[model samples]
Target: MIKLENASYSFKKGFSLSNIDLTIDDGEFVFLIGPTGSGKTTMLRLIYMNILPDSGVVRVGKYSSNSIKKRKIPQLRRSIGMISQDYHLLADRNLFENVALPLHVIGYSKSDMGDLVIEMIEEVGLTGKENHLPDELSGGEQQRACLARALIKDPDIILADEPTGNLDPVTAFDLVKLLEKVNAEGTTVFMASHNYSLIKSRNHRIVEIHGGKLRS
Candidate 1:
């Protein structure tokens, strides 16, 4: 779960987020819809403690921005999954290696790492493409690989920023359906997207932010 209590963050004199109070509960799929430069990314960063709030509190699971230690950020991040528009796959690394990176970072056992990575890849429907590099896959397949990488750790929450941004309409819809399946499996999902039309028909909680403040 994630919660922000009157959280505020400022980048400069005029552009900043102010008094944001939001909550994302366990197993919920919440869509964050906003215009460009509306602070959606800032809000996601705050939830994951990538950046601290200027004031107020941000609570992601047990870690609180108000008091969490710097050294514990990695541990906090391990409990949360992150996906982005660009896929962020390592071009030189194949799907298996890319998705296994997180497990390697945490020093997971070799056998466990293999099992988890393969399971995640299959979950995201990239089972047969384990040895393929990023460029070898289509846009949707690449994004699916990104999703596998994010899910490999079995994180409690998934924060996706414009996850379907680069795909064609049909592919984007398929990707969202995969996200829905992930949510159905009990992982909480909070996705930020600028294209309202892409997500408008989904029966999920939609929160809008404008001018650095929550509009709904």
Candidate 2:
């Protein structure tokens, strides 16, 4: 679960978010819609505690941004998976290694890692491409690889920041449908997207942000 109450934060570059109050329940699929520079990414950052609010409170599961210890951030992150607009893959690593990276960091056994990583890659519809590098794949393939990496961790919550931003409409729709399948399997999903027209048909809860504040 994720919750924010009267939260506000400002960056040195002059952007500011004010008085945000939100709650996302477990297993709920929520879409965050807003214009560019509307603080949608900032809101997601607060959930994962990438940046703390200058005022008010942010709670993601049991970790509170107001009082979370620095050492516990890794623990918090392990519970939540993140997919960014920029795939952020290690260009040197092959698809399988990229997806296995998180599992390796968490000390999963080699056997478990092999089985789980392949399962996730297949889920994302990239089975044979496992041995390929990021440069060898198309944009959509890279994003799906990122999704596979995120899902391989078996996170309770998924925080996706503009996951479809770089993909074609058809590819984006396929990605959204994949996310819907993940949500139906009981993982809480909170996605930030500016492409409201593409996702509006999904009929999920939509939270809009503008002027750095939540808008009805």
Candidate 3:
């Protein structure tokens, strides 16, 4: 579960997130829509404990921004998956190595890591491109690779920040469909996007944020 109670944050430039309150139960897929600089990314960062609110509290599962220790932040992040517009893959790494990165951080055995990495790569339809570099993949394929990296750890919730912003419309739709498939498998999905057309036909909860304030 994720909850924000009267949470507010401020930036040095006068932009701020107001007293935001929200609740997302386990296994729910929620869409967050907003324009550029509308705090969509800020909200996700808060959920993952990248930054804490200056006032009030933000909670995810058993972790709370109010009292969580810095040392424990990494442990909290392990349970959450994150994807973004820019595919944050290492340029020097191959697809298999990139996908296996998280497993190494979490201390998985080499034998187990290879099977898990291959399984996730296949799940994202990148089965034959394990040796390829991120630069060699198309925009959509790169995004899928990012998705595979995010899912390899089997996180409880996925926080996608404009994941399809760089893709064509058709590719964008396909990516959302893939996310839907993942959600159906019982993982919660919280995606932030500005593409209304890509999501209007879908049946899911839509939460709108404008000027850092959520719309009722």
TM-score of each: 0.97, 0.98, 0.99
- Give the distance in Å from residue 38's predicted Cα in candidate 2 to where it truly belongs: 0.4
Residue-wise C-alpha lDDT for candidate 3, range 1-216, written one tens digit per residue: 989999999999999999999999999999999999999999999999999999989999999999999999999989999999998999999999999998998999999899889999999999999999999999999999999999999999999999999999999999999999999999999999998888888999999999999997
Better of 2 and 3 by TM-score: 3
Residues 36-88, model 2: lDDT tens digits: 99999999998888898999999999999878999998999999989989999
Ranking by lDDT: 3, 2, 1
lDDT of 1 by residue, 2-90 (tens): 99999999996678999999999999999999998999999999988999999999999999998899999999999898999988999
- The stretch of ten residues in a row with the least summed lDDT in candidate 3 is 193-202
RMSD of each: 1.1, 0.8, 0.6
- TM-score for predicted model 1 compared with the true structure: 0.97
Best by lDDT: 3
Clash number for candidate 2: 0
With candidate 2 superimposed using the best TM-score fit, by how many Å does residue 119's alpha carbon deviate from the native? 0.9
In candidate 1 the C-alpha lDDT for residue 59 amounts to 95
